[model samples]
Target: MLLKELSALASPLNDQQIGQLQKTVADLSPQQLAWISGYFWGLSQTPAAAGATPQPLAAAVATAAKPAGKLTIIYASQTGNAKGVAKSLEAAAQADGIEVSLYSADDYKPRDLAKETHLVIVASTNGEGEPPDNAISLHEFLQSKKAPKLDKLQYAVLGLGDSSYEFFCQTGKDFDTFLSKLGAKAITPRIDCDVDYEGDAERWRSDVLGKVKETIGGGASEVVVPLHAATSVGTASAYSKQNPYTAELVANQKITGRDSGKDVRHIEIDLGESGLTYQPGDALGVYYTNSPALADEILAKAGLTGDETVEVAGESLTLRQALIEKFEITASNPQQVAAFAELSGSKKLQKLAEDKDKLRQYANNTQVADVLGEKKTKLTAEQLVGLLRKLTPRLYSIASSQEEVGEEVHLTVGLVEFKNGDNTRVGGASGFLAQRAEESGEVKVFIEHNDNFKLPADDDAPVIMVGPGTGIAPFRAFLQERDARGAEGKNWLFFGDRTFTQDFLYQVEWQKYLKDGVLTEIDLAFSRDQAEKVYVQDKLLAKGQAVWQWLQDGAYLYICGDATRMAKDVHEALITVIEQHGGKSREDAENYLNELRKAKRYQKDVY
Candidate 1:
């Protein structure tokens, strides 16, 4: 009908052009067609089409039909921070009229490294010095003997990590060193960012893009591509850390028995009119305030009154408010401890700071007040505030699928409480959610999408999930989604806790799933129920034959729990299973697991 109307009236295009336009529009949906109309208008406003003097766009197209040099950005992200920065760089580059392309480290072929002219790597280290799961292949290729020398390449690296870890930004450091060894020139010095990395990241982006603009033959342009043109097809809500949705706490029910040592709460939050939606493996980032009592205790230890004025991130506020709402006081890091030791000049702290191992141990076990009370020195507000990092939002895995509960999100939160002398310290976010927050109270939250950790696209593929304690959150969502979709895949769960009756989280729900045939198999490992302590790894070892059989039959494996110990132990257990059952050597077993990871058959969301 549109083509007939165009034929009936006078049009801008000739007969052949009209027919071609019709063919193109025939396959496009309404949204795509509307977007094309706006895009065509944008194209018409270009200088070449407007019969004006040639500008940068026209000149660029006339010269080579593309920009002079290519700026390729590859991001190796574990929990999405590095990916976010890489996307920002891509947008900035496009705005500067530079030819930029972005790819995840998983999708980018390492063999194509020699073809790049300008490159930027945004990576985050996993646990210790390991690269993220998606980056393992690329990282390994660059370090192997097969790597190519790239004397013509110029690049820079931006590393995002936490200072609390021993090997801060190790993956980025590895990439930088690997590229340097292959003769790639550094465009700028590598920047290793701590948790509060926004300011530094912005500066680094400016410097790197300025350098690229000087080298690439494209001037900054007022007419740039629309962000929607480069974005994904679906339109996601604009709720994020910077602009969070004010959600209401629907419920906070304890999931553990009274005799349990752990305090775990099953939380439900109402998304309401926020238009927020999330998948099973995604997390919800919650902004919280510290307990006022803990803030007062820290101020008292520093020998400073709560009324002292302090400046935080260009905002002036009382020291008490800053401690309670802005800075982190519950968890102390080695960097902060070292800095505080220098300020106080306490002989004990100064001696402790000299030993890195002991300093890290003390920082991990102690709190802010423990370090401040080491000396009788009185500190000004500025001096005391400088000892802490900014308070960051906490991320909890989503425990319910949108399929199961509309306009609502669920979480399994364990209250983080520890003893410091006679005082009991609680984590900022957990304390807020478990103790301070009342039913129907407001909480700021946003969805954090995790594409790296998700169920297999094939609904018929079997899945083996090992999630202990609160790690059981995403599995619940996965099971709910599978049940909703009526997936025919076999499901197996290996769960462990301290006691069976006291610590078994969501026991009735798991039993229901089993009885209903949604769950194929279930294994429980109550560490204290037997004479000796048993964990999930022990269960996996005991069922090594069946685990191997399932793997051979094409099963996806998932692990979500403590990265420091549980994940490592489970990983070693799987390697052993492959070694003992497949009659493979230790190295071969490790390589088999690596291949599985590269194939996306094995995934982990360990913290």
Candidate 2:
């Protein structure tokens, strides 16, 4: 009778379950009921095997595993590449009956490091060998005085980075080294991967999983959790990075003035009911066709007909089509340059390639066409393809939120154009989006979601955005999103460029936003406007007192710009402001900022 009354909400629980629930709670008070509610909530959020401990937080991070052995998968990604690889590995391991947990480096507490039986770190190195933002705390913790010995820990590392950089996989190398120094066992050697990291990452994952399976005595759970199987929010789209949606280009207008040194386009693409929705800070991946003119030049220089069929990555296509759609023809790196030099047998080129410094300088300044144009070598299509890396899609920070733009996605694309000797060269994607393609033409695209960079969940929290040059892209989306949501959080922006008159992008909308009171304050730094070149950091120092006050008031500080110089300079400036206004020692100021980073008050999206 009581069971029948409890089914008022149309809960499908049978009489037995209802009776069990009633029996368990019949003698309990309201306090006990609340406690029981929370207990079951945790149980639901963390599902484990009958005897195992369910992981905490969300299902994305952990899975229930046997006490004896549980595999841990952790990723420190600047972009979504390493996270994607880690998730794929997590799903695979679960499918193979291996109990596993997946964690973003920031979320995984350092204290639990020693308790882990098996560990795999998939880390991506950011600009100049720096660890990704999420990994900063963990990386520093491991290197600090309070670091613990991991005598029983067995770990493996997979580093994702571009070989073009001097320290290709420095972050991952550091992690592996730190763990090893702390007495952790390395089950497998560290593998540093270049831009095309999929194959190597997969191989490393397989090897690590196999090693864990052999070492661990307890078996995996029969019922597995599928975390990455579907989109966490909204409707899961059929399209993804691997299988992208065919979106048509609707608009590609030059946002920057013609006189400006930069060529930035405000591009719009029609989603057309792809049902792919994205957050403000997410990136849009675009797969573009290479320049036809450049492709023709390569074929002519190689003395090959366009009709010749070539095999690449187990696919057969006409050489001309491959050059246009598949191969990377515009840029050449040291590896590509050295490989070409060896094949062509040019004595001068071989001599230059032998010298690392000269080769790097030569490769950075030249292109594949230049190499082919220099030497007269009769090469087969297959041989030529072997020398070049595959064409990878470019990712641009989205400039418009779906909340404001609806089905159309907007991007602020900065074209990379320069003179390479006698010929003009441009970035593959930028040139295609800005010059070669028409408005009605279709482009393959997908969303690269970033969880690390986001507006505070608390809509009332203030935001301080520092984005200069083309980095202003995502901040545009942020402001648009805040406006659409009617979020009362104060918005402060610091934007810089060469000249405000010619290079101030989205000036009209910002003015309107300011007039509408959506933006609380705006600061501009035109580097060439005065006798003394003033950048964003100078503006920061000038208003250092106010900036420090904002920090004390719990404002979220965000920076998106060039990582090499601007970010470093601004970081030092922030520290100086903290020390000057907050009145702390240099070391204390550093610690304060580190704490802010840990609290997610300071976030960056630098390349």
Candidate 3:
């Protein structure tokens, strides 16, 4: 409030002017302050009228000046993490006084690539090195015969993915390769980051901005885009991966029958005025406190006393506390295995570490506790923390639309529990939410928005959704949202599982939707119902004609489920249908599907 009230400082403002300034800020929220700041900045760019009164420093401070040259940022994200990162980079670039234009990968025209002066891509690898739904069009276009030479362009890329997957950061690699082949110059080398991406992302941003600053000297600005907002209640959200809100767990129930082989949970959390906004395809990220029981086992295996001191995230804590609150100990990876193998010199670990494939298999099959326990590696608290990745939250596809449930979000969480050695291993977040956390207990959560996966903008457009197993989460949100809006679009759903009797997720809701005529047609597939396994793809082939007809009728096709097999098989089935019904070769049929994707008529929420 120092200089905010004009009278508080030595200023030339008259009483009336002071009163006006106070009134202007009286009801303004943080975002309003930010916008007004930009607004005045735009005004400052225009030369002031001659002989006009000198304005307050605040007005001058709000200048929207930018650095020299234009920078284009395009992001391809399935669960919105890359978009969030891209937006963060845009804000940072704006702060450095650079003009930035942000676009979803699909929104940017391929023809424009040859013309871009400066471009940066923040892409996340989807399943098995595949480009995300939004990235597919651009990915294909660059490799297509129509792509132009981009010798005139300068670019950078930042890829985000989980290192546990074999093709970690493969999308970014592909993008870099394609751009190089097209003759584009690298502004800064591409950086591939694992799930613990924020730190690496920050470093990449600083280095890239430094390069931009060197290439394009700061000067007067022109274009302006939405900068990332500081976390506050007034904006869309302040709660995110960095600072999640603590929401209470109101319900945690088993959605599937007790007889089912898989243990999937229906989870609900009370937002409690957190103002967290999410749509149908968004994900709920839950930060869990590692199971104390497991944490103790890890500490004991390292031969460290529970009370031994350790530092994590800049705070000092006991060894036990740090293990539970700071590091990832459940899943093993190549890096972790290599670190342990080298530290302990275990002949068995040494042999496994010699080969990449064998190391990966060992990591996948083992746990952190088991690795340390196997070799009795005596380690200090610091050494142990140094060996592990920072604890990261797990994201579950949101099942409830805000349109249907205000101030509350639902998640379909499939518990990840399996056997390893003599003990049972459970996923960090999944174990916490589904097994450990009691009803009404608090849980930390945030929304990861997905713009690529959305309902048809046209209410009358037909939609075909194929989601089997826990993949049905987002479709539930879709139907709920459609029902709430009284949409008249025909809805067709093809859902499958091992058995209808025990594995059909949300069966009651789909039946209710059918009864209400909201669902135009429904096809069910229960793999174990008969002698032959009948999955969703089987059903799709059975009704291939109708599916192809829907495509011809301007239907939007959506697929969510297992990316490793279900998505691929369903894709093959759809191609076969197009070939048979539309009378085309395999290549033409594939082209047809690609066009559908390019037109945004086909979308997948596969993991």
Which one wins on TM-score?
1
TM-score computed on alpha carbons, candidate 2: 0.84
Q: What is the C-alpha lDDT of each candidate?
A: 0.86, 0.83, 0.83
Model 3 segments beyond 4 Å from truth?
1-68, 219-235, 354-358
How many clashes in each structure? 0, 0, 4
Tens-digit lDDT string for candidate 3 (101-172)? 899898899898877888999999987798987889899889989999999888999999877677889999
Which stretches of model 1 miss by more than 4 angstroms? 1-61, 64-68, 221-235
- List TM-score per model, in order: 0.88, 0.84, 0.84
Ranking by TM-score: 1, 3, 2
Q: Which of the predicted structures, 1 or 3, would earn the higher TM-score when compared with the native?
A: 1
- The digit string of per-residue lDDT tens for model 1 on 310-388 reads 8887899999999989988888999898998899898898999999889988998888877887887788888888888
Tens-digit lDDT track for model 2 on 435-537?
Answer: 7777438899999888768899888899999999888999999999999999999999999999988899999999999999999999999998899999999
- Misplaced by over 4 Å in model 2 are 1-68, 217-235, 344-362, 374-376
